[model samples]
Target: MMLIVTGYMYVEPSSITEFVEDLQKLAITARQRDGNLSYDAAMDDPHAGRLLIAERWRDQAALTAHLHSSDTVAFVGRWGDAMRGEILKYDARRERGLMDE
Candidate 1:
């Protein structure tokens, strides 16, 4: 099974640039982790202080590894105070046809 994570972060207006730089670093590190399918971040067009992140992993084990990875830990330690957000995860399965839906 695949895992998908999506969320929005509310950054301090004055810290948006710093937050984006940190997010880019985090995304780069995360993409290099084993079983990482994708990691992406984007700014919300209509919302000045909001940034969105989406992540995909191969499985629960992979996601767990990422959660405990040093990169993630260091990112949190370095930039945690500059933003606030919620991330939600979901188990994903591919559907081949409408009949299967």
Candidate 2:
């Protein structure tokens, strides 16, 4: 089974640049983790201080391991009221490309 995570987070506008730098680091590390299919983070709206998050994992075990990974903790720990987010996860059932024939 595959797992997908998606959400948005708001960071202090002043921290956007640093946040992006840190996020890029996290993304690079996460992509190398076991069972990680894909991971990405990007600014959804800089003016609104909103950033989008998307992740795909091979399975629940993979996602769970990642949740407890040191990189994850460090990234999260950096958020001391400097960030607020709403995230959701799902177990993919059927999915298809919008452009698939």
Candidate 3:
């Protein structure tokens, strides 16, 4: 099954710019990884210090591999202290066309 992960990061106001730069680099690397379907990050409009990330993977195995990737590990170790966040993941089971319903 495909996996979809989404979340928000609450960063220190002073660190927001740096966080964004790092996140962009991470996203680029993630997109080039095997089984990575998509990776994106955006600043929340109503929240000054909040950034949102959404990712899609081919399957649980792919997601697991991503979690263990060196880039991912380094990113966490490097910027973990600059932000706080939660991630939620879901398995996609079915899809239907709008006209089907």
Candidate 4:
């Protein structure tokens, strides 16, 4: 099963640029991981300092590897104070898509 990880983050206005840069690095590292399926980040259009991250992994093990990686620790360190909310995870199964048709 794919693991879906979503995060709703609020960054300090001053750290927004740095936070984004950090996310880009993390994304690069995630893509190189064996279990990574997809990792995307986007900012909220209407809300300043608000951002969202969505990730899909091949399985729990892959996601676990990502969470335990040094990149993840560094990413967290860079954004720890800027983070406002919780990171959420869910087990996902694709229910409908072009392939399903």
Number of the top lDDT candidate? 2
Over 1-101, each residue of candidate 1 has an lDDT whose tens digit, in order, gives: 99999998787777788878887987888899889999998898424678788999999999999889888888888778876888899988882576775
Clashing pairs for predicted structure model 2, backbone only: none
- The per-model lDDT (C-alpha) reads 0.84, 0.89, 0.86, 0.82
Give a tens-digit lDDT track for model 4, residues 1-101.
88888987788777777878888888988898998989998887324678887888999989888888988987777667667755799988764676766
Order by TM-score, highest first: 2, 3, 1, 4
Clashing residue pairs in all predictions, respectively, total 0, 0, 0, 0
Off by over 4 Å in 2: 99-101
* Residue range with the least summed lDDT across 10 consecutive positions in model 4: 44-53
Model 3 TM-score is 0.89
From the highest lDDT down, the ranking of the candidates is: 2, 3, 1, 4
Total backbone collisions, model 1: 0
Q: Number of clashes in model 2?
A: 0
Query: Tens digit of lDDT per residue, candidate 2, span 1-101?
Result: 89999999899888899999998998898999999999988889998889999999999999989889998898889875689989899999777898975
TM-score (all chains, Cα) for each model: 0.85, 0.90, 0.89, 0.84
Against the true structure, candidate 2 has what lDDT?
A: 0.89
